[model samples]
Target: MPDVMPLVTAVDQLADRLRSLPQSRLRQGAAAHGLDLARELSARAQRLEFPDREPRSVPDEGLFVVADQVAVTGRDLAEAMRTASAHEVAEAVKLVEEAARRCEGTG
Candidate 1:
């Protein structure tokens, strides 16, 4: 059989990462954006097992809540991945310093 192990592992990790997002905070933002974050999460959580068949159906309310939390957590991880692509601490530090400078006088 084909080596599907790696793919399965990746999916599980993705699912886990998604589940970690903070739904409570994201929910309010999602609402403003006309998104149903919880629904998105539930849908993703249903895929945690990485089934070969079509994903199982998730309840709207439950999914939305889960999805919201997942999104928040996922976003941080995604940003870290992208930042890593920059390939240097100096570059990352520069970005952080710039961001900090933006709020320096305001707070």
Candidate 2:
């Protein structure tokens, strides 16, 4: 099994940052960015877990839940990719890290 701890840690840190952000910051753009990332991660997980099935979109439950959405979707992806190729896992990690970086200055 590929060690997916790095992905887990990255998402945890990103979620923490999102949670700590002020309401103004979240409202400005952070929440949207987080939700986008969550949806992407969720899509990837669904594709990996069930290639033949249609992926469901993660809903927008307001800014307050963005952090939880990111964390939950990310972990779901990590779990789905547990048996995936190392390269594939690395790509997912990179995707998440890049999302975190992009969220550094949300609007």
Candidate 3:
């Protein structure tokens, strides 16, 4: 049987990181969406019965939220990229990359 603990741990860590990010419009939106995804994953993990014939895998519900976050964050970042100062542009790029990485299961 595949171990699901790592996936759960990753999701939890990503959620915590998102929550603790600085309070910018992009981070705020992503944090809210990420927390919702994390809550859903936690709830699903608690309900798993691990029956003998079942396949062990993390639930896909969080994927939708991740995609949503990416879209929203990407849009916001694009706006920042268009007019922000050098430091702000760099920060926006970092935020967008982080969101994409989380969606790709590498964050």
Tens digits of per-residue lDDT, candidate 1, 1-107, equal 22333323332343453345356533434322212322333344334334355644434344244434434423432333332333432333333333223322221
Model 3 per-residue lDDT tens digits across residues 51-103:
24433332334333444443333443333234334554454444444543553
lDDT at 31, model 1: 27
lDDT of 2 by residue, 1-107 (tens): 89888889989999999999999989888889999999999999999999999999999999999999999999999999899988888898898888888788776
Question: How far in Å is the alpha carbon of 27 misplaced in model 2?
Answer: 1.1
Order the candidates by TM-score, highest first — what do you get? 2, 3, 1
As a TM-score, model 1 comes out at 0.28
- CA lDDT, every prediction? 0.35, 0.92, 0.41
Task: List clashing residue pairs in candidate 2.
Answer: none
Global Cα lDDT for candidate 2? 0.92
Q: Model 3: how far is 60 from its true place, Å? A: 22
In the predicted model 3, the residue pairs found to clash are none
Give the TM-score (vs. native) of candidate 2.
0.96
Candidate 1, residue 25: the lDDT equals: 33
Report the lDDT of model 3 for residue 55: 35
